[model samples]
Target: MTDAPALFLGQSDQPETLLLSRANRHGVVAGATGTGKTVTLQIMAQGFSEAGVPVFCADVKGDLSGICMPGSPNEKLLARAQEMGLALTPKAAPTVFWDLYGQKGHPIHTTVSEVGPVLLARMLNLNEVQEGVLSVVFHVADKEGLLLLDLDDLRSMLAYVGENAERIGREVGNVAPTSIAAIQRSILQLEQQGGAAFFGEPALRLEDMLRTSLDGRGQVNVLDATRLMNSPRLYAAFLLWLLSELFEQLPEVGDPDRPRLVFFFDEAHLLFTDAPDALREKVEQVVRLIRSKGVGVYFVTQNPADIPDSVLAQLGNRIQHALRAYTPSEQKGLKAASQSFRPNPAFDTAEAIQGLGVGEALVSTLDEKGAPRVVGRTKIRPPDSRLGPATDAERAQIMAASPVRGLYDTPVDRESAEEVLAARRGEADQAAADAKLAEARARADAAAAKEAEKAAAAREKEQVRLDREAERARAPARRSNRQTPVEALTKSVLRTAGSTLTRELLRGVLGGLKRR
Candidate 1:
């Protein structure tokens, strides 16, 4: 039992270690502020890395950045090492820094489709109706083969759904415009809080977080959450999304010798704060089921009560720091925390919980057989890495040396729902414009035809008038040239007499010529 390979957490009677094989059962580290919870986290992170198990943790206060740099020996660290009867060596874990905003580390992003509607509804603080509307939006996107890659895509989808609420609602569900508007306002609020940067491409690949360095040490991915902490909902939703992604992407390995990845969720209270019962249940379910995928989820928070009981029950390893019991509620919380631990007959667990000093915690971890050991009042080990924030220069150097340097630094805005809907809207607008133009042209043609017909009618009337005038002038000439019946008879008689006289002259001339 003593020779079993384990993560040396702290020393009670001897070295109290967490069995590496049982690490995927999940754990919790709870303490009030300045109770060395971060250091405990750092030590565990170091152990996991040294064991070649990759770790992902949020750098909530920027302190975890020091894991990138080697630690400096100090009197306090040396005293703790000597007290724990171990030689503490200063070493740094291979670390890769990440930031949601891309300012502090490599930008970590996930597409809207990746985040999905459930977490998004929680992120936007949507009510049931709004949640339903958001779900419908996602459904419509899927049905139309629209890729929702970024915030703009989501915005466009929401607008599209709003514009076609009746039609889409009939297909998906009943989508209320008010619900859509509320979701829209919620998205805008999230954007203002810097949540918009987290949705886009190229999205973070889960394999990147599981990478180990060339030296075989696990890569410690430290997400810079300094700015993200302001939007607690976004922070929670992002972490949940990551967990969901891991659960979905990683194949089940059963009980492996070590976890595929170990996740440290700091400020874990945000995950459950005002979370709906259904979401809480889903989270509890993920925590329970994800272990089968060989992933370990450790929740770091101030109070044990912050975690839902269902989730808290799944955590096998517990390192609880001191809790102050000045007020009644605090006393009640202290009682709850103290009662949660498996009692060690060596000391009063409740008294020990109150009296534990900084760097000391009540440690309990799963045995090699996958059962919780009796809780022990233990002095936690100091981190081999530096205990404070890294300098800007060091962070820059680490980021520059990252294997994924150019991978996610630049964002990609691929053709998504936003562009597609915009094109559709443009086409629709152009069609409307064309139709209007056609209608106007038809009206203009009709008016011109009407004017032409009037002109033609006027011209026909003028031609008729000229023909009548010509006929009238001819009629007067005909009347003036007209003769009486007697005149007509005299003319006829003269024409007959002329004919007879010509004939007689011709006959006389012929007779005279013949006689000569």
Candidate 2:
């Protein structure tokens, strides 16, 4: 077997922390402040990176920058190195930077819709009723094939479904208007906390995070979450989305010699605090099942009590750092942390937890035979990477070179809910406007025809009046004077013309009525 401390974990004396190639299915790292917890995490991450297993870790503090460059060789560092028995060689490992805020690292992004309602409800710390309503909105979106690609899309969709709850319920089934309304209101509150940025395209692909360089070094994916940690809801929601995505997307690989992706979750307490029972159960289930997919999840926290019993039990490999017990609660937390490990006869674990020096941890891990190793206090190896932040120019250069820059740098609005909904609304408005115009035109035509008919009747009346006056004048003249041939012809012509005019006017009136 190889004597490399990176692969074999702790030595035979400290067999408890000695993890075999196969036993690192998944695990947790817990300790208090000033403990070597962060360093322990660094060691594991670097080890996994060396093993050609892609490692992803969240950098809560600014100090994890050391992982980006090799540590400087100093006498104090060399002394600590000898105590750990690691070769005094400083070296750097492959690393990639990621961030939620565009300022820190490569912008790590995801759409709110991809996160879905199940996980969002958990993140928002929604009540049961609120969650139920959120589910209805999601159901409406899903039934209609509305892609919830970002937060805005979801917000717009929720507003739509809420406003038309009855209609949606009839068409798609069970969209409670009350629930919809509540969800809409909750969404606004969520938006206030920078939820808009979290939900949109330019989303990170799962493949990009799990990658290896051409030189055979595993890529160390670092999440720059200095600001995101402030919002526990978003952070927790994102973690769940990430975990579930891996579980669902990745195929089962059974037990592999090494993990395909090693995920490091910092500030692990936020994940379980006040988490809904349903959400907690789901998380527990994913943790148990994800190991077979060649994924290793390592949680980083100051206190072991921060993790739930159910989750704590699934962590096969463990690294225990020192804890300072200043308060009653802290003392209780420390005692519980020590009890999590297998009892070792070498020293009192409870006493040792308080006495361990920097870079030294009470370690325990799985042996080559897949058994628990004896817990022992051992010095940790120093990382080859620089323990300082990278320059802006260097960071910018690295991001520029990343293959994922062009891939996820652009946003895709797509033909999702926004487009489909807008089209439907546009069509309805156009139809309404067309109907109004048709009605207005019909009224205008009716009024114009009535005026024409009135004019025609009036003209016919005037013609009859003029003919009566002429006949009266002729009768008087014919009666008073001698009979004349011209007068007689005039009377006969007038009679014939009167009958034709009367008939023709009546027919025109009938035709006008029919047309109307």
Question: Runs in model 2 with CA error above 4 Å?
Answer: 1-20, 170-181, 477-516
Model 2 lDDT, residue 441, Cα:
88
For model 1, what is the alpha-carbon lDDT of residue 336? 85
lDDT (Cα, tens digit) per residue for candidate 2, span 396-461: 777787767667555567777777787888999899999999989889989888988999999999
Candidate 2, position 184, lDDT: 65
Residue 349 CA displacement from its true place in model 1, Å: 0.4
Q: How does each model score on lDDT?
A: 0.91, 0.76
What TM-score does each of the candidates earn? 0.91, 0.86
Model 2: lDDT of residue 245: 90
> Which stretch of 10 consecutive residues in model 1 shows the poorest summed lDDT?
473-482
- Residue-pair clashes per prediction, in order, are 0, 18
**Candidate 2 TM-score versus the reference:** 0.86
**Candidate 1 lDDT, 1-516, residue by residue in tens:** 556668999988867898878999999999999999999999999999999999999999999999988899699889989998878788889999999999999999889899888999988999888887788888889999999998899999989988888887677678887887898899999899888899999999889999999889899999999999999999998999899999999999999988889999999999999999878988998999999999999999998988988999999999999988899988888888888888898898878988999999999899888888899889998888998999999999988899999999888887889889999999999999999999999999999999999999999999999999998888743456788999999999999999999999999999999999
- The number of clashing residue pairs in model 1 is 0
